[model samples]
Target chain A: MMDVADLVERARRGHPRAVARLISLVEDASPELREVMAALAPHTGRARVIGLTGSPGVGKSTTTAMLVRALRGQGRRVGVLAVDPSSPFTGGALLGDRVRMQDHATDDGVFIRSMASRGHLGGLAWATPQALRVLDAAGCEVILVETVGVGQAEVDIAGLADTTLVLVAPGMGDSIQAAKAGILEIADVFVVNKADREGAQSTVRDLRNMVALATRDWKPAIVPTVAARNEGADDLVQALDKHQAWLEESGELQRRRLARVRDEIEAIALTSLRVDLRDDGRLDTLADRVLAGSLDPYTAADELLA
Target chain B: MMDVADLVERARRGHPRAVARLISLVEDASPELREVMAALAPHTGRARVIGLTGSPGVGKSTTTAMLVRALRGQGRRVGVLAVDPSSPFTGGALLGDRVRMQDHATDDGVFIRSMASRGHLGGLAWATPQALRVLDAAGCEVILVETVGVGQAEVDIAGLADTTLVLVAPGMGDSIQAAKAGILEIADVFVVNKADREGAQSTVRDLRNMVALATRDWKPAIVPTVAARNEGADDLVQALDKHQAWLEESGELQRRRLARVRDEIEAIALTSLRVDLRDDGRLDTLADRVLAGSLDPYTAADELLA
Candidate 1:
């Protein structure tokens, strides 16, 4: 078996198997995996992480696939991290979204991985960003992070991404009503996917009106696309590029990257604490007591700390 | 100006102001409010909490309101707790759903309050069940918990309720596709809301098929309804009653309630630990060090525990 450090080294050298192995290690949260992540941290931070989120059935997976192909066609290496909800019964993901992008499965320029949400509360699994870092250090220029879009987790994905695309479909009732709060605010660019639908124009109109209501500073452009058919993908890519340009030219890119770094640090801190609590015998004892009626949970927790 | 103990006493005696104030204090996670929850704990475990969840636009709020009215009509005092997502910009909620059920606002038999998600990852906000306890202790016979119908939070809400109703609307794409994993297993009863829509029959068919596929000894029932018209509500209520009867007949009600109480205690303990970490000046230092890269977050967290 390849040791985690060796796997990390190979991943940093762009070995696909090594990259997959490293991600598995992180997701498993094995104590041994920490050394590898620590070693890889120095090599990370080169790739731009973009989060793609939308309500389910909005073709986020298809859009992600199109973006990967588009970027790969432009001679840029791309990585896609698709986060699927964990199956409560099997403790595995039912849909491996990476399989949907099988067209590029053999393409060396693109690397696609599907991650289970693993019952983690905040959108991506705990190891997701860490896996993205591995992909980043493995020579990917653009990493797309796709979340199983459920409100706050979607927002959390946006927070992680340098650029966020909030996807929406037409005819989803009152388009504004379907759009959760803060989703409209986070989009660097909004893509009305499945634009061939009847209500496509109305969806765009609704989006424009809502965006106009929200943003006072820089206006985000809405792009229409049929991602499944690959229609308007080039235009979508151009829009993304324009948004990136604005971020760079306006110096928001640096600020966003700084925020990402700050968030990453906080995430790591919380993960560490969680791991410690998981490993400590005291937590188990507290859990048992709390599960039993003998102790009030809050007081028991305080006692554990004390 | 009311003390927590006095507030608990007043709330237990059915004072609306005291109940509302107690919920606010608990939801705020204020240091001083812990005493309020503790004081109210002993008087809880009386109300039957039912969670209502579904995709957006399924009229979950409307269904919840109807249920509240139905329960009140039976001469059972009811409480409605609507969980809205916290505004990402303001870190507060608009609490607009209260207006949707305004008819019951002035009814002494019904008490309705909206609680913000407060950045809590899951639907069962850490403070939510505690707030429910307050209502339970305040003499509510049935408590309705409504969430912003997404996926995981929906599941969390389901798990927290004595009985969970997964609402679905007609013609909303593939019913099976919409029935995500966590939801299928958690929903005790499937409600096909908006029965007036075109695909209601097919949705019911899909739900029945899905339930048949499940291995559980007790299969959940599919009930169709147009909540806005109050059509089929009596049947829905009858289905709920049948399920409750089953629980009672099998002695599962007591078992489930016990398990829930245990889970609540454990959750409370974990939350209290988080609060302690935040309050004891440990988290600040840990955060600073992790941000500065002076300490690895994992190690810093370990040290704090040590």
Candidate 2:
């Protein structure tokens, strides 16, 4: 096996190959992942995690590319974990999206990797935070986690992010759909992409009205942008910086980070316990009893835990 | 404080109120859940669970209502659990969706309940199977679990169902979107709703082309329907019956059931362990250590398990 310490050293120096390799270990759940995480742990908790999410066709890739460009313009290193959909149709389209981000490919300060949201259960849940830790340790000042679709996965991205931007397009019913998906509540900033289109004003108005209804300590800022044209990119970056400042000033950043790590530890612990139960044949035995109608699952679980 | 035995008995007798109460306990994660599950265990495994999922605005509600009508027409007792999105916009829309199912509301043979996918992590994961158990033991011959949205939640529903039907609409980009969300692989049957619409044939053809690409033991059946007009309801039901027969003959039913129960047991065990670790203060100490960089999360997890 390649030396994990050497990889960590190289990653800390902003070596893209080293960072990508570390994340690959995470995504593959490699045997060396535990070592890699240990080496990366002390270097983390520095990167600002910004999550970008919306339904497909809201120009998430375009917005992400624009944000990367703006962040790089500030002379700060950046990383992006674009959580791509693993469908044959879109799976093939991921290359097209990547081509858009090639503007940063030669820049050592920018690291972009796409993690496929495969069909396996908890795959993203297990891999995402670890990948984030890799980027954070590699000295990326800001790590953008962009995910497609508006459902539980989007909510999950919110939980991982320090500032979450919910993207919507004009006249796509995206505002109402975001509201219905509960994506509105989790957003720290709302980006009205394709803003030059008709109905953009109405979409923004609807979002503002909904935002007005909720009394939060920080009201999510609404910014309109035509991502394809790179309009409002500066405003979007400013909005993100403002949220970052508020997060620190209000002490919400530390709290959110602590809570995030707490969840991570709990998730890891639970997964370990589950693996032990399954590998030991205890789970199968209990499951057989439950399937035979001889015992309840709760009681069987209690027994396994005991 | 209600007697668990009495509640289970009433539920077994097809008392909708009792069934609802039991499910409420499940949803609430009540302290007496163990007793309730024990009481209901013997009566489960009889109801064939059918999960219908698709992107929003694809006529899931209408198709579900139509399916309830068709299932009821056969004189089989039915239960419908509509997992609604908990958003202000769609929260209100759920009432309208419920009104459509009111066609069978007054019928004692049909039980309908809507569960909210609230902003809680693992809320649906922990509660859904328990609710299905309640419906199953209540003498419902078939239980339909309908979920709105196409993401991880939809995949979770597929895991819980004996047969999963993925709905798509003509010209809605539902085909590509469904494929992108990876909803295609989880489906046992594909419903092309709104078949009278202009792009219906192409939608069906697209689904067939994708379906043919995968090499599975059982290929998903594609059925076109105008659910609002109640057209193709019989064919959908027949398709479901055919899949059910194949599941039994191919021995996939037992295998799927075993896997489902195994997952259920593992989830319960993990949840119970998480609660134990959290309540005992061990998790806090470990998380704090990990946060302080004194230890990595994986090592801390191992310590807690040890």
Candidate 3:
């Protein structure tokens, strides 16, 4: 087994292999996770975490690539975590993702990683939190989590992000779909990507109208951009930065960070509890009793818990 | 307080109010849920549970309406559960859903209910299993759970469904998106709705191509339908019946139902455990120990379990 402490040191020094190994440890729920988290704990909390989310075919991968480039232009070290759909389709799509983002492949300042689903219940949702921490500990100034906004996997990304940019495209019904999916509630900023396409103005208008109806103090700004051609990307970055400033000035960032810590701790503890529940034989006993109808699940749970 | 035994009897006798109240008890996590489930247990396993899943604008409600009509033509009682998005957008859209299905609303043999999100972690995923039981015990020969294909909430619907029909439309990019979201894996049948629309044939071709790539024993059949025009709905129903017959002959239905029960038992047990962990002080003790750096979360969890 590789020494987690050594890996942490190497990762802190911006070694990609070490960084990749750390993420692998997180993804696999390795036995060394505790030691790694302990090592990483002190070095985290520095990265400006951004979550860029959208439905498939809405240019999410493209927008994420452009955003990384814009940030790299400002001399900031960037890390990207792409939430790959763990399906037969990902083999080709994730390859396309890598090829599309190849501009940053040789840039020493940028690191990009794609995560596939682990196929365990709640497993996909749990890995990103720890992976973000690893990136933060590795001295990344900006860490971006790119995910499709419409799935069950999108729920926990909001908890991990300091700012969330929702991407939509004209004729995608994405703006309205985002609203219906409750992704709108979590949007700190909305980007109407593919602005050069017809109906971009209408999409932006729809987003603004919905934003107006939101009762939150921080109204989400609608920024139009053609992400494919890298047009208006700086404005998108500026919007994200301004939102970050607003979060900090309003003390929401601190509150969000505190809640994130609580979430991280709870998630980790619950995952551990689940592990022990299986190994200790209590889950089987409780499940069997419930299945046999000898005990109600709630009552059996109470017994096991007690 | 309502009498659980009496309500169960009323529900089994097909009283709409009783069925509604039982579903409400499940959604609210009422104290008498155990009694309700015990009483309703024997009456379940009779209803054919079908899950209709798709993106927002793919005409899920319309297809559901047509499916119910086709089933009713054969004199089979039907139940419809619309998974309401439960955002601000839901208020209008849910109304639209009801209005669109109002044809069945007046049918004494049909039960159309809309379920809103419970706004808690895992809440949206938890309600369906119990509601399916209620509808089953209420003597609905077929129960359809209609949900938007995207979102964290849609994960467990496949487990609850005996047949999962994934709906796609022309220009939705839904075939590729379905493959990307791993929705295609859960589909026993694929419905290319709005068949007269442009690109419908290509969508059908894409689904067939992907279906051919899958190694499952049961090949998911692609059925084309124009749900609004009520075209090809009979063929969709025939496809569903064929799949159901295959499941029964192959004993897959029995296995799936057993797995569904096991999943229900496990999920309920876990939810109850989480409840007690927080309320009975175990979580606090473990959390504090981990937070104080005296122990890692894994070890603390082991100590708590022991």
Candidate 4:
């Protein structure tokens, strides 16, 4: 058994191994991990957590790799948590996301980790934000979280990040279908990956027109990029920087961060309560009534809470 | 301004207008609606809630319409809650779902209501399960909830239903992509809708293979149907009946129902807490921190809870 206190201390001092080990502990949901988190919680809040999400094949992984490289080039240490779909058959799988940024793995300034969704339905792996915290505590200046495309989980990502980037690809059928209204609302910045593709201009036009329809406040800028080729990577980074600056200048940045904190705290509390309810056998009794057809679910829930 | 107690009582006695009105109130999230829900909670759970979900254009709506027709043909009263995608411009949108089932809307034994997602990311509308409860309280023997497609929100539908049916269509690309493993694991019965399509047979074969890969003890059965022609509507209903029987015989029905009830209660509670947090202005503070690069979200979250 690893001493969580020792690990926390090492992680706080910028040990990559300690950071990696701490993230694994959190992902495993080991009982001892909670103690480590409690100790490390105070040391967090240093890194800028940015979330990137889009549909599959939207170059999210490549984009994330590029961002990490850009941040590192600017003398800032970077951490990347790339979430991928987990295979149901085998609970254990490789963090294959590293393949996209394999060239940067040997670079001391950049630390990248792949996370599996672990049967979680949302776009984010349940352990992602927590893992990002471990990196933040380890002194990473910027933490980038890449999520699986536009889905239920993706919506939650916006609530977790300081600035959220909604990535889109050209020629993925109707741009509107690819960029659903739900996703459009959350994007602080939109990136048109594969900008060299045929329908790039039209996709950009559609996004601008659609975004124009939704909000009268700050209009999100659409940045064109070919992440695989590293084309326009620097501009994308500048766009992110500009957005961050605007958020601070407008004071909306502080407002969004405050809201994000409240949501995370409430989410953690609710999750804990759910686990307690299940483990304490209250859920079993409620399930029994629901199955018997004698009590409907809504009523059973009320009784359980009572 | 109407009396909630009167509405609950009227709905209990099978008043369609009262049921419709109550659902509308709940969907609108009116404070007075909470009182009606509290009163009707005890009356819910009498009806079996069934969820039908699949990829877009997979004949989900058509299948739901046919299922309602078949169930009603057996002299059982039915309620249908069809969730549609909402437009970004106006929160209010057309209810195209009920149009497909127009034949049954006039029948006293059948009631159909279409719900828009209200910009919520999840497949089933946020107001969907609550609407189903209203129908359940109104003496509907079976309540069928149809989702727009397989997305982040689709996974949530399974947690709400006693039995879940995953619909798929032929030539819809990869079966695995169309019916992602996340949604597949929750399905009790799989229906290959639009079986008249050229690749229907192969789709069924692929589904059978996928079901075989699932590690669950009780294997879900795959049924084929031409929903438009109503060719296999009877078989689809029979499959649902068999699933119900399997649940009863295996003693798993009660267990699953209890789990669903517990989930519903927790979901409601968490939603309530989020609403409270938002109203108390805590969320705004957290959002502010997130926008400023100084505070990491996880630490900020801990502070908010403390």
The candidate that wins on lDDT is: 2
Off by over 4 Å in 4: A38-42, A73-75, A84-98, A116-127, A150-155, A172-181, A213-216, A279-306, B33-43, B83-104, B116-129, B148-155, B172-184, B213-215, B269-306
Q: Candidate 3 at A247: error in angstroms?
A: 2.6
Residue range with the least summed lDDT across 10 consecutive positions in model 1 chain A: A85-94
**DockQ for all models, in order?**
0.24, 0.49, 0.28, 0.23
Candidate 4 per-residue lDDT, tens place, B1-306, comes to 578898889888988898888877766766675577667766776788888887556877788888988998899999888665442211212244556678886798887887654533222433666677789879899999876544443346776777889887888646345334665677899888889889889988888888888888778888999988988988889999998888889877666666665665555554554455556656566645543545544454455545
Worst 10 residues of 2 chain A by lDDT: A85-94
Higher-ranked by lDDT: 1 or 2: 2
The residue-level lDDT of candidate 1 at B128 comes to 77
**Cα TM-score per model:** 0.84, 0.94, 0.88, 0.83
Q: Per-residue error at A305 for model 4, in Å?
A: 4.9
lDDT of 3: 0.76
Task: Please report, as a residue range, the 10-residue window in candidate 3 chain B with the lowest summed lDDT.
Answer: B84-93
In candidate 1, residue A199 scores what lDDT? 91
Q: lDDT for every model?
A: 0.70, 0.81, 0.76, 0.70
Candidate 4 CAPRI category: incorrect
CA lDDT of A294 in candidate 3?
60
lDDT of 2 by residue, A1-306 (tens): 589899989998888898898888876777798888898778888899999987668899999999998889999899999876453334544666788899889999999998864643446766788888899989999999987654454237777899999898888664375364375568899999999999999989888887887667989999999989999999999999999999999999988888788777766776666567778677888888999889999998888878
Model 2: iRMSD?
Answer: 3.8
**Candidate 3 clash total?**
3
